[model samples]
Target chain A: MRPAAAPKAIVALSAAVAAPVHAHLVETGFGAFYDGIAHVAVTPADLIVVVALALLAGQRGTRAARYAVFALPVAWLAGGMIGARWPSAAALPLLTTLSFALAGALVALNAKVRDVGVAALAITAGVLHGLVNGATMAPAGAGALALGGAVSAIFFLTAILSAEVTALPVGWPRIVVRVAGSWIAATGLLMLGWLARSAP
Target chain B: MKTQMKRWKQYAALGAAMLVLAPATALAHREAGQAAGFLSGLAHPVSGLDHVVAMIAVGLWGAVLGPPAIWVLPVAFPVVMALGGLMGLLGFPLPGVEIGIAVSAIVLGAMVLAQLRPPLWVAAALVAFFAIFHGHAHGRELPEGTSALLYSLGFVIATGLLHLVGILLGEAHRWSAGRQTVRAAGGGVALAGLFFLWRAVA
Candidate 1:
């Protein structure tokens, strides 16, 4: 076969060759919405941050928990919107990691952050993460509905986890939550190390 | 046409080289999912007798110290150890990681054996200091290709559980005879630590 024709043949054959990848936006054939959910579920770093933020807010009190449950999803969606429109990026390798690391550290410390402070943190984490998630979809125009799916997932998780944590009686249950925070913090630091070691 | 032939020759040579070197880069990914990642992480630390004894000793010592110290020591060690792990991953030089691990075992075990209740801060600092070495070793020696997040989670969880076991063993401290038994166990751990320390140095 001629070289040009060979290239054409390969392109045609590629239709049947499918493989899953760790790319930002993954299409699950279940539509854009499920894809969005899958995106968050598969991404451990994002999941960790989501959980950490909830734990931190819950530790802070009911007021903070309310702020996180509302603020985070909204902020994430807003960031995703900007990211989808934004273009030409390198990597923001550490942004989410830094966010989670800081959040986890606060949870471990059981810091004296107020509800407003917790809300601000949720916004910041949500936006930064949402922007990155949005960037993944921008090139393909992966749609706002997909981002909505992800936001809803985060919102539900925040609502459920923070509520559970907030309602715990004030003794060893609180201590256990703090212990979990320490574990999350340790995981974050380890992740940071892995990134640094793997960085060129 | 002659240039085309040379290109073909180069392509053939490259293909041959790739065939020859493929095995060097190929790794086993058969057991490469999340379960494998977590299980390995959980197993690796406990596999090492040195790490296990020390971790359990912290719990035992905590039980002896009673209440807050019991929880506090276990909590602090992992966090500090994680920092050490970060340093290790970043290629920071930490002299005597192995030695430090061994000494941690000896010191913590001795504390359990003697039922010494040093100030909480002193005990915590000592445990934290030893934790760095353990964390560095863990960070430095992560499996080449695995789910790092799950692996770390498994590791931390395993460490926590081991500490719980020690705390449980120390529960014997509730009774005078049981307290003696716990101290005897501590002495045994300390002796084992000495063996490990000798192995490390020798």
Candidate 2:
């Protein structure tokens, strides 16, 4: 009876130690939220689109800026919800690439777009981006991911908006912004080619 | 108090020893089998300093050349590289392949440092020539029993992405200070190339 009791105690102690290790392997709650933020930060294609869109909105002035700050996040969340429900959309990457290309080109041209047009672009960009994000995010972490993504998007937009309003320099600095637009466009085009080549 | 200090010193020494031994113990077990397939191929170019620097130099040179060169060099490289890869797969000998790769970094980095704008064709040819060595190295490393097509796709995409990063950095040439910055980066690449060259020879 004593020997059997000792074995049982050892087994219980081992189980207690292993439980936390297993929990660490499967991230939940705030860990998942941080994962979502990291996911967006690491994706170059996603980052280029966000920066280009924000820059374009800012270039179109305060009204467009105001519309983008509000519209993009709301539309992104809506799109994420749609994607979570139906995850099999094969066209999201291509659509995302195309939208990014168009946005970059528009920015490079410094096109004068209306506030309504900016809002429309914002919605399209947000939805496409959120769809991709949602498709990749694990089901168990969907809520956390959405929260993190929304927070990141807001942070990025606010930063870009501030730069556009206050810090963007004149002459060469302005040209640098345009050049960045071109680079973004080039990246999009390259990715498009890559996808086409890799397509089964 | 003296005894406590001695005890703390002993603990510190033990902790330092553990820190030194930690990395060796962690890396003691290498998985026995070769990693095969697309993921392995994708990882190959990134794993080698020689491959990464040369590929990036190609993009930097292209961006320095501007316009058609920017587009043309990148396009020409993989096509020519595929030919080299074929040679490698066929077991055709290319001697000093590692040396050639290191030299590519040197020459290409020098070109960037000097802001040399060779004719578009010349630039394309230079990149294509170096690409062969890089591609052959990759092709030779294709793991046994892996799908060649998938492996080729993986390396090509990885190589292209590296070129894109270089191009983005090269775009710094749009500003005056940016031009200086890019040249400074070129100098750094050249120094790195020299180091790799030294290692290859030694």
DockQ of each: 0.32, 0.04
Locate the minimum summed-lDDT window of 10 residues in model 2 chain B: B25-34
TM-score of candidate 2 relative to the true fold: 0.46
At residue B31, candidate 1 shows an lDDT of 21
Give a tens-digit lDDT track for model 2, residues B42-154: 78779998788877888887888888677567666655565566566555689878878888899888898999998887887888898788766765565665543345546
lDDT of each: 0.83, 0.67
- Clash pairs, model 1 backbone: none
Q: What TM-score does chain A reach in every model?
A: 0.84, 0.76
Candidate that scores best on lDDT: 1
Model 2, position A139, has a per-residue lDDT of: 43
Candidate 1 residue spans exceeding 4 A from truth: A1-30, A87-90, A137-142, B1-35
TM-score of B chain for each model? 0.82, 0.79
For model 1, what is the C-alpha lDDT against the true structure? Answer: 0.83
